[model samples]
Target chain A: MAKFSGVWATFEYLDEMSHAVEKIREKGKKPTVLSPCPRHEIDHALGEPQTRLPFISLFAGMLGCLTGYSFTAWTASDWVLPVSGKPIVAIPPFTIIGFELTILFTALFTLAGMVLLGVIDTLRHPLPPAVKKYTRFQRDRFGVVVDCDPAQTQDFEEIFKSYGAEEVHIENN
Target chain B: MSGTTFTYGKINDDMLRMLERPHPSYFLLLLGFLTALGLGVLSLAVQVNVGIGYSGINHPIAWGVYITNFVFWIGIGHAGTLISAVFYLTRAPWRTAIYRAAEAMTVFAVMTAGLFPLLHTGRPWLAYWLIPYPNQRMLWVNFKSPLAWDVFAVSTYMTVSILFFMIGLIPDIAILRDEAIRKGQKLRAMIFTPLSLFWRGTNYQWMHYMRAYLIYAAIATPLVFSVHSIVSWDFAMSSIPGWHTTIFAPYFVAGAIFSGLAMVMTVLIPVRVVFGLEDYITDHVVQSVCRVIIFTSIIVGYAYATEFFIGWYSGSPFEKAIFYFRPFGLMEEWTLTGEQSIGFPQIAFFLMVFCNVIAPIPLWRWKIRNNLVAVWIICGLINVGMWFERFNIVGSSLQREFLPAAWGSYWPTVVEFGITVGSFGFFFTLFSLFVKALPPMAIMELKEAAHPPMKKEAHG
Candidate 1:
């Protein structure tokens, strides 16, 4: 028999996604989140390293900066548009282009960061049968779970409940 | 907390008596409003007859009194949102008693402000000319015109501000409606019944109400800063010499808020005294306002210096001339032109800086900022100073532009002056009505402020 357990807490504090990571790391179980914009401080309480994606914004901004300056430089001097007598290496004017690029890329990176870090649909993962009955894991409760096997299942329910799991169940495969 | 609880030092028996009985002292307010409205009507007709020309506008100094009044009202509008969103976000407890009046101030000031640009227009009827969509006239509004952006900014600012005021009012309206119905007060119950929208303070309603309120608050805080910055841009973005400054957007905004907060003090001091809401408003609230005024004043001072510094740095002689001519320039001093000090826009600049910046520092003391008399006086000075800033910026910059030959002074005719007074009245009239219409405090939020939301970890 497989063991089942769930974690529940309000959206900000015991956030499902943050909980899922802890379960998988600590006890080989998956955790989940049921809300948006969980508090930053709660990441520590949940024991999950901040791993999602705001850094992509910085990376994209830097990349956009280089691309913007390069394009501006090339168009003004390298490509040789002979129709007008515009200055080559116009750094002041290109600064405006750089500023615009920085804003555009930073915004795009923030959107990309959210998609990559958090799974939108919680049910798609292929975990062991133990997590199937733990749908309440995303509710207003917080629990830490450990997967137990029949060989180690001596009073498994009591042990899990003592550690603050609201409910524990066995899944038959 | 003292007996007066919040606003005044103590809640005296007389204050309770004043609140209970409808004394003529309180009723005299209706007379003030009527006189204000009557003056406004008569002056408006005269203003229309004489045209904007009689108000002392010329080609170069075209923006004069009307723009000054616009910036002033917009600045007056700032304190409402500041108290509502920023104070709410930071969880300032005292915001409960003061936020409603501030929001009312915001709505009225915006209404007053929206009129000035129309007044500034040569053809106020063609005010609709700012609209972008092609009409029978078939001419598209120039997207690049700063004025066109203003039409969008001011209208949107008014819409959002009204919504924020209304959203904040809903629960209080329900409370008042209930009180009126129970007491058998006909007029109030009739006025507020439909507006209550069937609120019963259920958990579900509170949840959704809170969510919507937070969203509006979030939107308003940014809008407060952005709206005036857009107004300042109408001046700063132009290639005109004194008008072109990068620092202007922020400077204008800070000054706007500073003056706005000062106006709040001015209005509230009288309100607290007259209504005897001593327990509702307090010395600490006054002190907090003083602190904000000080902070914004310093920034306003910093902006003044930076403008001169940037002009020097840019090394554009035209820019340099514009800056120099502003205060110290002989041409700016009306004595040189043989006009009275009234026509000297430079006088407006000096007074603006003096009132908005220099005059408020003594409030750093526990005595001055907390003293009702001192605070009221300072608030009045700040009002004067802020009005000067707009005059200095809008009028002087136009007066001392690149084309020296085109420059002339503006002098507001009696009609213009009377209308300006009327706008102030209009602003206050709306504010007074709002005071009576709803509880001035966010009673729901007060619960959380008095007691922090219980963390689930407490149970854990």
Candidate 2:
């Protein structure tokens, strides 16, 4: 892994944080933004790609519906036991199980997708030095950590300060 | 929005402090519940050893307090999903503060409810027979049976609710991890880190997280409605007089939401006081919840009247006899040997009316709805009324059948009563532990609701 040095800046306001992200991106640096809550404006500014979770859940739910219905029908037919004189492959009642499993599988797959696509993204990228240095980003403060050469640290700090950053920390690792 | 004075930092700190600092009273209350839970476990062990006969269920009333408790708890499970999923989809901002605990209640109530069928089955060891997996003997579960439907419904409901609850917890757990690292609590940080899944609040992660949460919420809404409806069908599918009504599905769903909301209040009232969460879970939330209670109570009241009307309108002598016996209990002239002229069923009918319908009428007034004590008392009463409502529906109808010779009444044995109390103990113990372990509020969602990001404003 190529070790990149970075400077992280904390801003009290979302606007200031977004302005700082725009500035760093203008300099051809990828800035990692840490926020207390999700912001639509920040996502637009960062140009974050849309996730595939919805499509994944849709396919998973359909499979679940199939699995649920077929499981009941196949098992009943395998046994060849008629219940209360009803047909072995009862579709109407089996639909309830199918419906429940559809939701269950959809939810399970969505969580799995979230872990695979969302959380893993964070794990794949190194933790921002700022997150380790200043804990406020997890609570109230909005922050941006920009990866850069050690020689460019001062320039990034100045860009951050001009955008109303309350504090700046440089980490070279 | 008018009442929200919290900043993101303040909300995070307030919730985190509760998890970090345990109150003396919390342990005291938990100890009381744990002791009750221990007694309940002892009762269950005795019942298992002695056989299902140790319960109040007898020949005619094969489904007694155990089934009643099952339906009651499952019904209570409904409100949590209603608040968390249904309200979330409807964009009800007030739910942001209360939904976490409500979701927890749903998951726990379902767990508690899931136990009853196995407990009622005499041969609980054969509970796996309920599953329809392929086997060597080629025995499959009865797909047409409502009891089998319940296994699928309750299990799926539990599965979906737990997933929804855990997904919602991730962001808050990440916040806890960050706080733990800051506070030098290495052990807590180590525990929270992996659970948080390395959430860094990046927009990419939020994008996926938001969409997944919306999908879960969408599915959970219908799942909650279905679980309770299936529970009601367990009675309605039968040919027995009171259980044969077609209105059972909607009636049970409404009653379940009503009771579940009441349980949320019963639990949250004490929780807010103990945790000092008055700011987040305010009187507005209480009033909003009470309004829902009143609406459902009316539906429940209508169902009650409609059930009697249907019984009369159907003109079946058996239906009329059961309805009449429910309230008036076989007039003295027609009393059979071993049958009381008027019994506990009669008393249960009136009590159900008073608690489920008549008692909540006071909630229409702002004074009663907003008053914490009054809200708590009424919710407690509704919880009681709903349980009796299930009891009356299950026990009374079973006690009298088409053949008068087969009719018999049921009164729960000591073991059955102990187990019922113990289920409550188990529920509260899980809830009490949850409050202490995790952030009871959705800290991130609350901040989003309270102070949403401005659309047009930009940096100067």
Candidate 3:
């Protein structure tokens, strides 16, 4: 993650996250770039692709509509006999319940999906040393982590410096 | 004391401190509540022991006190939506001081309004039968009936009101959560717990919340228009001469808002003074609302003329005679109260016109509109006049409904009169309590009112 920060990384380093895999191939270590609400072409820069939300919400909403409509219709028709000549399964009357249930399920599922996605409810992320040093991501600084702790003496710094690296902050993970 | 300086938020804190202790204002309010509550208790006792006959609703007008109070309180409820949404949209700064109380007024007045149709029902226990649900009795209510429409209209309106109120309370609940953490206040935390719903104040949560609230507001806009339109349709759909008119949908909506704004102005002027919120609720806000008042005043005037023209143009003898009887028909033939009935009850006629139409003309002239004294008096007149308009429309119209044999009248009985006043007390009592518990304004809106929009966020 530190390998993807902008503040810790130089212009050449910015190009590393921009052209993340290229630098990763150069470094002999692969890296992944992330975009929740994309800054723009960041995914394209990293060559990763994705789509919005789960198809499950649409299915849930459809199911809810059918359930609501059928319940209202059944109750009016089969469950009780008509006193007058009025139709037992009046679709117009059941439309209200159907519409309300559709919106309700869509809203409920979207909220559940966000929680499951770990968007904001990051309750227990332990702070790694490198991530702690780069907590400036919370504010204005955007720098990419090179994944090399530098403490490893893993020769990663040499590989990073080769990519026009301005400065390297070791991530103590 | 008359010309002292104070901060806006500071006034609430100071008032709270005084209120927490034994202050004169607190004692006065408490006394007022107790007195009104006593009246309510006594009235309820009579109502429970006796019957609906205790009310002034009899003969030609089977709806009197309860209905009058119903319109009055529902009109009161209108002011809340205006304060919360309308004034917010218009950038009325004065809304800060009064919006919360007005919303509270909305909830309590709705409660009061909900009671009327039930109270009007002689056997109140059978009221739940109005809900169109399956039952063992194998009975179904008429879906086409206006009363059924009223049931749906009121139910939908109340639901929307509650949603609007709860959404507005979310940020304030967060504020309380923060305060509770700082002070380790048990009561504060308990109140905030459910309302906060584990809000983390994260940017994502705020974005979602903002989107939901905006969607609800957009949804509520039409609900506000339709709910009142349906309520008005209750009368217009009927065959009661003056009540039956195509103009009513708009006319009733206009009248409701017209009366609603006047009520807001009256309530705010005194409230701003007591709460010392002059800076936030400035003369500009009053004038802004008065602008709406003036526009609607003209519409109401046009409605009056349009009704008369409609009667004359259509040449419906019944409609024509109803209008003619209002101002010129013989007293021997047409009945009204007292010798005042002789030449049209000029008092009732002029009172409605003067208050609804004429009282707001000075608003077109900027100086008088902005003048606090003049504006307050006019607001008072508007309140009086709007009530009289309803009385004339409901009372006078129903009193004569085309059939001479069914042409008796109405006056409020003691129980009916007491309950009406009690409802006012109920509304204000809730409003006062809300002021102490919550930030009276939408803080975000107030902040926006002070500043311009921010640039869109970029994750980078």
Candidate 4:
């Protein structure tokens, strides 16, 4: 089945949570921190690299531009209702189509990328039940959930408390 | 959030409270708009059942009030994107409190605007013919046409706007979802869970989510300019004297932002008062918006002067005649012949000039612009003016074309008037429901902008 054993700590203050995060990482554990809002401090402490979402946006945008230009050009040429000396497939007007589609595709694909990547990440690490119970973590509290053995639960709890955690739940599944 | 201090929990509670059952007056207000919407629906049904002739549109004046309304609403939608996307890219702090409502306005305004073209067509069923899909006839929509371009631009603008708006809402909805779970509201929680996309505020989600938001904003920023520019081209591409001007794109865009900011202020002022959110939607934001309004107003005024200059300077009698007819319709001839007669186009022209150019000039004064009541009135005037501005451009130009024999005047029929009122009702009704249904402010973004709760030791 699924494992729910971990140490879930909540801090009222951002600094205290960042301190707890640093201590947990020093102890050779990667702690999953949650907050009501994303913090630059927490991000800096976690030291994760930038996401690849921009690449996806760029790729989608280029695809949209190419498709937009080609589709318009091809359609106009195929259905030759020759206007008064205007070019069969004009560049200036077609550019408008390309420009609009670029934005549309870029926006749609970027959102898709965020959702897909987030789903993959969620699958890799299901949320601990104890962490889920503290709904206040999405409101006023900042949380750090780290997995450890049943024996080390006490040690982790003390470390959390030492860093001034408002509450700590030790789960031994 | 700049001058105000709010704890994360307080922010959540304050915003959620807006979604709670409002005062009795709120329902009455909703009822009034719903009634107006009903009237609009009746009118539209009548028009559809009878014919488009119920509207005051004929040859030379076929693009009457409906096209004017289409341009006006589309213009109104631009400021929302500007506030949400452009302000976001620039990292303007004032946008935090105001952008959510503005985004909602954009979506709803576009919704209201989309109805006009369908209503104008008299056969909304065949509106799908505007699309470029292949059919049995092997016929495709003309790619060279600006109307075809409008079909793509508007739909794309609407889609991008909704997505950008929704993406911004996800984190806030997640908070609301968690709140529901905490309160034991199972149904509310279940509803919000999917709407939130099961957001958990994990670092992984934030990382990707933040980057995606930036990318969307970046893409949407240019879109803000292009969509309205494309709309302006709908008229500019035509050979109409007043409509065919190089300055129309920028001129329309500036007016769009001007009128849009006025609208945002118009709605936000009352909303902030009603919800007791003055601290969040502060005076500073209003002043910033007023400054933008002043800047755009000047550009709009400049465009007006430029148009007159171009009319006279181009040495084209057609352009000159249309310009002269706009402000002083039949005045030159009427005065020469000693006849006292004035046209409706003259009234529209003066109203446009007064509302768009002269009315906002008071905002240049810090004392006047700072007064919310004053700001609201100016915005209301600008809205009236902007509509007339469109009318003057579309109606006056078409009213007196190249051939005096082809000259005719157009006034909106009662049915056309009902439909116009209905579009407003539709917009306001959607906005009323939106504020109660969703967080009118960007809760997470507000929290991000605020100083986080920190330990005394951490402060050092």
TM-score of each: 0.69, 0.94, 0.72, 0.97
A4: Cα error in model 3, Å: 21
Candidates in descending TM-score order: 4, 2, 3, 1
Worst 10 residues of 4 chain B by lDDT: B332-341
Candidate 4: tens digits of C-alpha lDDT, residues B344-370: 678788999999899999999999988
Largest lDDT belongs to which candidate? 4
lDDT of each residue in A9-59, candidate 1, tens digit only = 222233333433354446543333221112332344345333424356568
The CAPRI category of model 1 is incorrect
Tell me how candidate 1 scores on lDDT: 0.64
Worst 10 residues of 3 chain A by lDDT: A133-142
Model 4 segments beyond 4 Å from truth? Answer: A149-154, B1-4, B332-341, B457-460
Cα deviation of B341 in candidate 3 (Å)? 6.7
Best by TM-score: 4
lDDT of 2 by residue, B352-444 (tens): 999999999999999998799999999999999999999999889988898888988778889988899899999999999999899888988
Per-residue CA lDDT of model 3 for B98-197, tens digit only, reads 5666676677777778887887787778899888677786555544456765676676567666666776666556555545654677787778767855
For candidate 4, please provide the TM-score of chain A on its own.
0.91
DockQ, all candidates in order: 0.03, 0.61, 0.07, 0.81
